[model samples]
Target: MIGFSILNTINTDNDDLSGLNEIPFTVSYVTSIHRAQGLEYKNVKLVITDDDKTNMTHDIFYTAITRAKENLEIFWNAETQKFVIDNFEEQTQKWNKEIALINAIKNNK
Candidate 1:
């Protein structure tokens, strides 16, 4: 028994991958966050390449972090270290505010 796969990199001019079906055995998998919704894993390692603050929102960060059931790890390149740090600091402030609000509500109750 043997298996093979075709790694087709989509380009601006070529988008047709249907022709690959004639090759008998070819497979590809998508690990995108949108597609990973509803799936849970014991451990997850997420590596974010995009450091743009506009693209990396709190919701997106939360979604990616919450995917792991037990342990989750994150890695960023040196080029984006400052950006990552800034975002994390901002998010930490929001998290602390939320925690304080919850504590206030609990104390009132």
Candidate 2:
């Protein structure tokens, strides 16, 4: 009954679960945002799913917004036309930084 964490944000083709199977303790691959609820990690990595302003009111978005106990990291794909990253702990991390950065770069003259 021990807890170890490795937050993976690479949305690659490899079976991300492969490495988890070797660990002695439980290896829970909460791939979908729905499955990630009620979980927290010292190192949190959120893989940005294909969601955005057009389809923002999503359960996956809700689930992804609330799974962090400490540090949180995110991954957004290049193909995405619109993606919004939400941090439930807004008071702590100040969620607007990434969006600001993106907008600034996109609008640079």
Candidate 3:
């Protein structure tokens, strides 16, 4: 596996190349959802494996889907499909309850 690391340089001059000691190399196209946070891409391809689903959360799934600016594709098995459905339903119910409470408060005022 190829790993990439970030280098911090204190020099402000663009002509100072002495700070760079290592040769430039390419990085993998794949990245974790956590690492991709606050970043947008023209296209995104997401793959969900059984191991991934074990640690998957609603927020992570949402973040993955929203990463794509123009197009997004997802690949998963039936088990993962069921898990996504259940998670969506749970989130929907939670939002509905919150909205109801807000409406009730407004009526009581």
Candidate 4:
């Protein structure tokens, strides 16, 4: 009922974020993006919730975007779409400008 069946390969075998040891393998495998930092795997799929750019902090977006090794997917509703487009146009200009400056510096060097 989704886009691709290949996505099933990335299905996590274990999903436990709370690392409370007393809980025994209570912490299994799949972790939310926050806890998944500094880890690596073949594929990553993120189901983005209704909360969008208008509410969440920029760091949240940054963290979510950076958590992929090879494949990264995000599923969101209409609210998420509008929030992303609106916030992207507003904030990404500065990010683009900074990237351009960095490229210019590297080129000069």
Alpha-carbon TM-score of each model against the true structure: 0.44, 0.35, 0.57, 0.45
Residue 35 of model 2, lDDT score: 65
lDDT by residue for model 4 (46-107), tens: 66666534654466666766777788777888778777767767677888999999999999
Candidate 1 or 4, higher lDDT?
Answer: 1
lDDT string for model 1 (1-101, tens) is 33555645555477667544323543433376666777877777777776444467566667777888999888777766568668778988999999999
Each prediction's number of clashing residue pairs? 0, 0, 0, 0
Name the runs in model 2 displaced over 4 angstroms: 1-30, 49-57, 78-109
The per-model lDDT (C-alpha) reads 0.70, 0.57, 0.83, 0.64
Give the higher-lDDT candidate: 1 or 3: 3
Residue 83, candidate 3: Cα error in Å is: 1.3
lDDT of 3 by residue, 19-65 (tens): 55544564549999999999999889999987777667788988999
The 10-residue segment of model 4 with minimum total lDDT is: 1-10
Residue-level lDDT of model 2, residues 1-109, one tens digit each, is: 5666554556677756644522348554555555667776565666655654334444555566567667677676755424343333342254378777789999995
Best by TM-score: 3
- Candidate 4 stretches with Cα past 4 Å from truth are 1-29, 51-55, 88-109
- RMSD of each predicted structure: 9.0, 16.0, 11.9, 14.7
